[model samples]
Target: MAQSFGTFDIAVLDGGQYDPRWPLIHMTPEEAVRAADDMGVKSMILTHVGKFCISAHSWDEPFNRVVEASQGKDFRLLTPKIGKPIRLDGAEQSFSRWWEDIN
Candidate 1:
């Protein structure tokens, strides 16, 4: 399916917290990054978080892991503030690590 779509500037993927029991249904942060890479994505944002006890990881672990997984990669990992408007067409694409500000 990715080949049909070509490369994407942004890809929204599953960043649901990790659980050994249901690995096939939910994606770990590292896996999500890999999925983005698989699709030739230039940037990625993790979703499907914060609303369930679907996994063992903390509510914020997905974000942290996604950042770690993005290391040395060419693509950017975006975690914008909820309800904040992101200007994707801008000359520079940047997002705040807002998750860092919370406990």
Candidate 2:
């Protein structure tokens, strides 16, 4: 899949899970940063992370780690909390906040 994309400026990997088969597969937080750097991807966002496995605080560790690792690199890795708005371009907007109101 990474090869097919051929180094996109912003590659948003929706799911956190990683497959080892693909060399470019970001199986770990560190790997994600490396891949984005190598591919010249400007931004990488990890999605599909929720409270299902560990607490929100616990998840932040790995997320922050990736961000720190990307420091000084051209790419930016981010893991935003629920409710934050990400402005892509024009009027298009995306929210990171989970739908807690939904029941």
Q: Quick one: best lDDT, which candidate?
A: 1
lDDT of 1 by residue, 1-103 (tens): 4789988988889877668888788888888988888888877888987545566678777877888898887777778777766566746767777877876
lDDT of 2 by residue, 1-103 (tens): 4566666657665334444554354356666667676777856776645434333234344555655676788765545565565554535444332333333
**TM per prediction:** 0.84, 0.56
Among these predictions, the greatest TM-score belongs to 1
| Count of backbone collisions in candidate 2 | 2
Query: Ten-residue segment with the worst summed lDDT in candidate 1?
Result: 84-93
Q: Count the backbone clashes (under 3 Å) in each candidate.
A: 0, 2
Off by over 4 Å in 1: 1-4
Candidate 1 CA-lDDT value: 0.79
Q: After superposition, how far is residue 19 of candidate 2 from its true place, in Å?
A: 12
Score each candidate by Cα lDDT: 0.79, 0.55
